[model samples]
Target chain A: MPGWYYDKKELRHSPSAQDGIDYKTEMRYRKEGARLIINTGSKMDLGYNTMATGVVYYHRFYMFHSFKQFPRYVTACCCLFLAGKVEETPKKCKDIIKTAKSLLTDQKFTTFGEDPKEEVMTLERILLQTIKFDLQVEHPYQYLLKYAKCLKGDKQKLQKMVQMAWTFVNDSLCTTLALQWEPEIIAVALMYLAGKLSKFEVVDWMGRNTKHCRWWDMFVEDVTMDLLEDICHQVLDLYSQSDAPIHPDSPPLHSNAKQQMPSLRPSNGQEKTLSPDRPPSVNAKGPPLSDVPQFPYQTFTGAPPPAAAYASVFPSSMAGPPGGPPPHLSGPPPHIAAPPPAVFSYVNHPPPFSTVVPPGAPPYFPANAPPPGQPPQHRPYYPPQ
Target chain B: MSFEKSHTYEALNRIGRGAYGTVYKAKDKKTGNDVALKRVCVPLSEDGIPMNTLREISLLRQLNTHDHPNIVRLLDVCHGQQMERELIMYLVFEHVEQDLSTYIERHSKGFSGVQIRSLSREILNGVDFLHSNRIVHRDLKPQNLLVTHDGHIKLADFGLAKTYDFEMKLTSVVVTLWYRAPEVLLGLTYATPVDIWSIGCIIVELYSLKPLFCGESDGDQLSKIFRVLGKPPESEWPEENISIKWNSFNVNSQISIDRICPNICETAYDLIMSMLTFNPKRRITALEALNHRFFLEEPINT
Candidate 1:
């Protein structure tokens, strides 16, 4: 089984070509799919955590699969179905499918077959493989109350800040912030964003001294104001894209962040309508077969079918790497593409301790330096500047 | 695409049915080590994969990170094509010879107090690990407790374990009725202490060589419990605390531990009593039970 914890280094990823979908395309489908979850999940009476978890699964699923091959709405339904189970509030598959089909008013949402259940199950197995059975997803909501209690601000202001931050955390799920940042970082970012909205001096609320550190410092040791601000901007970007209020300095949010996102904003009180502009072009040619056809089913068996048949079921571009799916799809797979260009020191993969060791340092001097076999040492200690 | 080549486990024989799938005793062809392969049959439906499967996987991953001997290790997870359409998910775990129930049935003559103490200590250790990590092993019964050939015990079957949340209104009816606590029977909000109650029941059952409360139904199960512990007082469990309407019942007296299992020592009786207390708050915690005089009375080495 693949390990769950990744520390900026050794986070696995396969190139977008391997999955036959570009990163942006996959992200768009994931966003739309997550929106479908919110639309359908509201009817099923799922909690916010379940919605957040379902969205995380959607984002994580695309890290391995291509949206072009696996129909976005079906995959979204599968994610919610799985999320419902993971969050311990299970719903029947038929009910989820019915609700999803009803919400996906657009004809483009391909019906894999007369009954979408089988296709959803097929996708469910792939979903499990993509996640490597590492099903536990830590959400920022779990930390919101704790952070709120620690803020040394006015009672009423703290309450309002918590509410704002809570909404920000939900909206952040709409963006790729959950995938890009740690849950604690998102929580801290939302808190800061909430404070800014309320005009509360949150930066030094926990006291400036290191001994009496900010609540974020207690949870995330290496977190800085810049990273928190960046996360806040990512969340704010989601709000701007939707009809919701955006922070003053942030650019206008993308159009995709429309009102349909129930988890992101307060209900707009408008009748729910699926946009007709999005056409069902992806599967317009294929017959709607509820059960996988015999040849495709055989391809799913252990025997490797010819590339052509396998490609039909799983497009060549979407084919998994020659080996089993890599452990964590946090960065590009080592073989195919270069790791995503490093952003922050902690963003993609941390540089090895040896690489961080300054020009004239002794070969084996750094106490915490890797003993050579470790190529990607995540805990790179920058010696006192 | 194929997980088969990487995960090859040859089936030895079928075990019993698991919570949501078929279990088999298999040999890991790679390491030639015997292991239990639970073929979790995730039905082909819109519901996606079963949440129980996910919870078991997630909780086992967290619990077995450091490899505690008392908790079953999730050795591997692999997918197999079952039938033509259905997908079979195999959760590979360390194979144990028998469960606690089977072990007790085989050794019906009796287990020494020392053996019983060791078993209780091991179960408590597993429970403590789970509770400390804020997980509640909602189902803790003899059937879910696996025992190795060398008498080592481990808690298995985490289909119902979950990260504990206080305000979250989880379903009341979770654990098997026989091991269910009074508060659970009354449909009250529960926590880790509910597990301790089940442990108390198991301790009594282990000592007696039979189930402590073997009721055919939920109502009967509660009656059996009240028969043994006496009808619980209404004051401790207020009307507002539980959802169930209070049923007026009468019992002459609470059955003494001596009458139930006279062979067990006084310390063991006291520990069981502390655990079986009606008030969940008053119930002995897993850690406290570990320190009880019953464990100290007989050194595990003996």
Candidate 2:
């Protein structure tokens, strides 16, 4: 008989919930691993795999076992041991105990030159105890791999997106939602989050004609504007690095937004910075929304530009030449009004993604809701970018 | 057991739980079919949910043809999630109010050989159809056999069933050990006769209103069977007769199958003996078992 504990429902926002997990821990895990793996061609590593297994196992163990009662490290160790068991090359019990000691000690466990086999034995006992001795919940990692399989052309970009998405999963573990979402959705959200961050060529694959996904628009807005960009900010703080991938010369990755949306890709080859039909202050540089002109555009960290400084970016649009209000913000442009209250202000910061309310749907994550750290699900943020 | 059923098939109560999957009673919105939906949830680690889902869909697309009256039909497959896990596959089964275990529980006084004859015949009929189609119901027990409110016995649980494709050689230790055939207990590879052994246990359950050979250990179970029909003979049970060898229980074992229940008629005894035979090759098929004098001679009315 198949041995699986199945819960198909979304657990986020369940009436009763636990103290949320911090998404940063997941970031630390991925950052440490990704720093070494990014240029390394995503080598298959037993370390990260085992680490992820431990994290997920620890995560699920808490689903039934309250975090209030159990030690998180114990839970983490349990997951690692369980993973070792499933991986089939289990270490001796004493090595597991030692690993646990090393994992918890001041001069904590470092995987460098130590006998990895011996270390695992010292760690196994505590891990087993944390697991309450049951190890049937091991899940297969094929979902992330299968999702990377593309139905369209230009597979390189999709592969790149997989890495970015995995980054999201790791970072998402820091958020309280992980405890709520199933592994599949968590994985999908990561892919969705990374796609939003990268604005990859596969964006077109997520639109109207995309089979089985009729809710593309909603998915985009909720995923992108809400979770993804926020996740990118949370994980990579890549708002500064956004322009590099946009450059067309990059191999495998198409820097042009048009590459992502063939429907909207400009055919005339005109630059968006010069387009007259663009928003007022069409060419406004640095922090597309800011109006401050104190520093040169290059010096600005998206420093908000003033209404007057914006008009200088595009001379033709500012002149109001042929029946058009200067594209720049002279006064309150009828579109976006004055800067209102900060949802949860962080100067260069975007709001926490959970609060993104799709047009018809309720907030993906309630802004007013107290932050519950990582559970399982982070939040659903569909990206249209 | 609570059901809003006809409206939304809300899964209000869980009647049965197991490692294999959970069985819930649901209602088909349009047709109002009171369906028992068994969801098989296999764990896929950090990966996405698409592949397993597609695999289940594709396989069911082929296997869904098992719509016989005696077979538990797969009504529908659900994937689009609601609030929870939308990745689950919902398999629909017609409402067979009670399974054999439940039926026997309610009918504790037990059935006479005449009544047992018809029920056993129906059970055999289901098994006969499955074997002929090359499907082996690997986990056949009273729990997998449903007795409808009308008292019809239909076989269920295709989750563990496998096709006898000549290319693939599978293990035999699948069905619950209590109902396991001797060949299976020894880890040897046998065919549908293993299912027959389960049917034998189920048949005895139906007759005596109690489990037959319900031992906790495999050794205890084999001994119980031997105490009844005598140990398997070495001549009949060649270690190579099947795929694997269980030296402890192999060759001249002379296990018996007598103490299971007493005072059974010769015809019923003969039918059970044929099914409980250690020599799987000699064990009668469901069709032959159906033609046995027990079923032919005694027609069940009540």
Candidate 3:
């Protein structure tokens, strides 16, 4: 089986770096992308495991392909969509897109293009191929819970420490720690950090002995202090910085777009200046927005142009009616125009939306027919992306 | 990490058809090795890949890390040409010549005592490895057991296997009815004990050359089991199985195993009885079955 881990040198020379994205700029894009996946998954009522898996998928996908090749937001949505099914919490593509639209500001939502569903569905195939269909991802949360059970300490303090460690693991998803280390090592290191921060020492664990001076020794052999602190510092770095600025030199969006692109990196010292105490943009919350220009409907055919060259690929007709039906719903793309294969036709037979039908209404409503008193309109048809 | 593309393997012949897709005997052009290419057609619906297929591939990949001898090897997974709306995925596996069912069918004469002992021991070893790894092969009929040219057994077709920790409320309808355990037939929750029940039925089939308790339906399967093993006392019947009443089974006396399969020795009979116990709690585990007296005793000539 192919492994997911990469060494420090391999990660430093990642595909994105090879595509002309500086390491710091690529890291900024990763943090924002991970945050998007976690936020989207939480809003959809998915568990932490599903969200972490999605983030891991995002990180791994960028390793094989450059961030310049694919838009971070679109890839984030596709990752979460695939993770939901892999984790056994299935959600419709339209529902996920709907939640994303509600969460994102109108400016950022433009990246989803005219048909958000088609964009995400199309990217799903590339995500699966890039990951090589190795769907199992072991996260640190399970190990943190398992190790906490073995420690003998004050119940409340232990619970608090474990909770802090769990949050650290969640934040660690933004970094490349997942690509660099196994879940066991990461779990042990985070638990040590939590214990130090909470002032709770594991003096009496289940298998405490003279040889096992440190609690982690009982779980994993030969864990050096240097390794644990290095892991802890990576997670701590997330809190030390307020936010990173988006690249200003990139092409500007439409004038009416609501999103406010922040000034370029402080080193550049060109373009509009950012206020020292400027209030954070609510449309794009969380980590500072990265410099990469968002490519809404850019196709991944051949060697994609670098991030600086993305202006040429931007669709000219992006300013469409906000919440109206898609312009091309009447004539879908030729590939999905045909009826779905009969193998899984039963799944499509039921009415698509669960919220539309009133209680005690007929269960066998024709998919094409609207409910009583409802106007006849095109219910958004989702063809295979 | 580049994967071997689908074009590298030349199709030789069609071997089998499954609910997922067809399996073909293919040859690697570069290495000159025979491989089994299982074609899985994934419908590109709103939901990208099927959940069951994802789980199956995930579980198999994890298990493949150990490289157990009795488990079939998943050599590679590569994408083929994408059809109009369906994606073709080929799971390349090490090919085996025959399955256990065909192997049993080819031997018109009864198997030697030594042959039966070796084959049964190999089967139990495979089951024990899976159980130790916290995986349950939900479907374990003869067709799923591949037989190599040298008569080695390699467990294959893990489409229904799952990695379980505690008592999971798994799908109620699993396993072929002929090899299904009573707990599954009665709709009661089950775990690894279900596999042991199937092994017990298989051990008897090794001697009788046919299924022990063959039935047409779930209820009929339980009836057939009761007729042979005799109905258990009301207290032993699981309280959770409300659909199956103790009185529904009219078996008044238990049939002797020797009458059903007289060719087996005394120790073999004892081992089979322990494996076919009515209660899953009392059913012989794979490890325990491996250490039974039948395996320890001298082989009796047929």
Candidate 4:
């Protein structure tokens, strides 16, 4: 059975389960850590492609290994570091380390940093092995620009809508949508949402207005309405919970420990520190908020963050729409149940060529239409009377 | 679960070696299927996994998703501890009977014109798939093309393959020297057209049993090309503003199809010439090459 099956079962466990912390709590911690790393990367002027790829890498890596085996923040930094190199927008290793360390230190968290270089470098190797060195990742950003160009509309409004869709792609990365859907599908769905929000009509690939065509038809033939709806819901879930506080264990950013992350490297062959700032109730099911210093980071400023400001870097909400949840978000995920394994099971037994639909095959071909220029596949015979 | 190399596969005799690693014939313990496992020893130091191996792994996985018939399949990936605490990563691929180079060697004189047409068609199909996916197989040559026992061809060895972005800059140093395109030899940034030139050279080799342009150095390579096809008109080098300094040589437009290979059909000759067109823009695309009369003829299918 896949790890996801175990994760689904674990999600149903009550808060009082017998453990110091449940998997849900651990997952939240890691997701937040990844989000912070992405924000820091963006602050460092990394391209959105690199940031998107890094978060996707972080998600895929965790599928094979749990948060307990590796420090989530450290892994997040390593993923960004590696993605920067893979995307050909290489960043100095020291810069990545410093930015990540500063973010964690501001948040009052700690992990091994005795040899920050060696620790990150070691984790980078492990990451390469975990994903089996498959580093090329496709992103929806490029497709958004392409689709926006193909859609015939007011140039200025389309530009604004494309920009909005671009943000939607960035925010969707915070969730598991990248891992679950094809980049094209994500791109189309986000464009759909952007159009709905902007009141502009999204067009098909041929630059025809999409008013009469099925919304899904505007996309490549492989995409289905169900696939787009599932992706839309996943993104919607992210927006719905945008106003929620950061993971409970995350320390407020105002903590004064500027050098809080623990140094993991051995010094004089002595024992390494496991975590920074040990609390009196270390064994408690959850950490107390009392020790966390009050901070003014926009996330914790107590003013309902402007939907645009929050969504600016990583929008959590899609507000100002005419009504409640768009008609698409109220349904269950697409019937395409669990996201397929990161490395497909089909690796061992690939699907045969006979089953491969040609690249542009219509979603639903006419039932009686024979394949173009070819005889009907069925065997012909004179009926016996 | 980790793909435990030792538990799943037991290695057989070593078959070949290259810059990255050694290739061994191995058996899948569970299915008893034979696989060609390329074992690359990746050191655990700061350099991490070599970028070339990473490129190969990612490209193979991406191509394997669609599983094109003419592209080799990557069956599995595994790693094991080697001596000196080094890590050996094994890329398991479907085993083939032989490669194009070996097939030609076994035949002594080269393949028949019909066999050349069929093989060229398969190569074009495989190249078409890669190009459609925005990938360029930078090092396409005869040795990299594998042949199954039943005479099917599959393009293999993607160490130099990369996904191309128009604005991206790439090193001109790719594809073997002999098969390298003129723009690449001239130190200009080249793209998918380079592969077409290399395929042209391979097609000639397939028909004549030897390399058409056997130049010892980059300079000599251009000379050989100019000697046979004459100088590429000034308009051909528009992207490259400066003119090429060619050796004082005579134009040889007289070298016709009959002179090159009298046995080759006219359509095959036409296709080869189009691929060898000096202008990158004019060079035949894999898709267009597939539709050439050379491939449409009945001789290619049988």
Number of the top TM-score candidate: 3
Clashes of each: 9, 96, 1, 7
Q: What value does DockQ give for candidate 1?
A: 0.43
- Candidate 2 chain A, poorest ten consecutive residues by summed lDDT: A292-301
For residues A329-358, what per-residue lDDT tens digits would candidate 4 score against the true structure? 223333432121122111111110011123
Scanning candidate 3 chain B in windows of ten residues, the lowest lDDT window is B162-171
Write the residue-wise lDDT of candidate 4 on B49-136 in tens digits. 4444455567667788787889988887666653343456677889897998888788776577678888898998998998887777
Share of true Cα-Cα contacts across chains kept by each model: 0.77, 0.00, 0.77, 0.37
Model 3 share of native interface contacts: 0.77
- Superposed on the true interface residues, model 4 gives a C-alpha RMSD in angstroms of 3.5
**lDDT tens digits by residue: candidate 2, B205-301:** 7766777776667776777677666665556656454543334542244534344456467678788878877888888898899888887774543
Which pairs of residues clash in candidate 3, taking residues 3 or more apart in a chain or in different chains? A247-A291
Candidates in order, TM-scores: namely 0.55, 0.41, 0.65, 0.63
- Weakest 10 consecutive residues of candidate 3 chain A by summed lDDT: A314-323
Question: Each candidate's root-mean-square deviation in Å?
Answer: 19.2, 18.9, 18.9, 18.9
True contact recovery of candidate 1: 0.77
Give a tens-digit lDDT track for model 1, residues A1-385. 6533333221224234466665445545555677677657766777766777888888777655666667778888888888888888888877898888776654755655766777787677788777867777888876776665556645544544554465556556667676677787788878766664443444344434666545566666877655665565555443223222211322222333222122122134332321112211122222332221211211111221222322322222122222212313223334632122111111111111111122354432123233434443222221110
- Candidate 2 positional error at B176, Å: 14
| After superposition, candidate 2 runs with Cα above 4 Å error | A1-49, A60-75, A86-89, A97-141, A167-177, A196-199, A203-385, B1-180, B184-195, B204-236, B240-302
**Which residue segments of model 4 deviate by more than 4 Å?**
A1-21, A106-109, A138-172, A177-214, A217-305, A308-385, B1-7, B40-60, B76-88, B106-112, B128-139, B159-194, B210-260, B273-288, B296-302
Q: lDDT of each model, Cα atoms only?
A: 0.62, 0.46, 0.68, 0.60
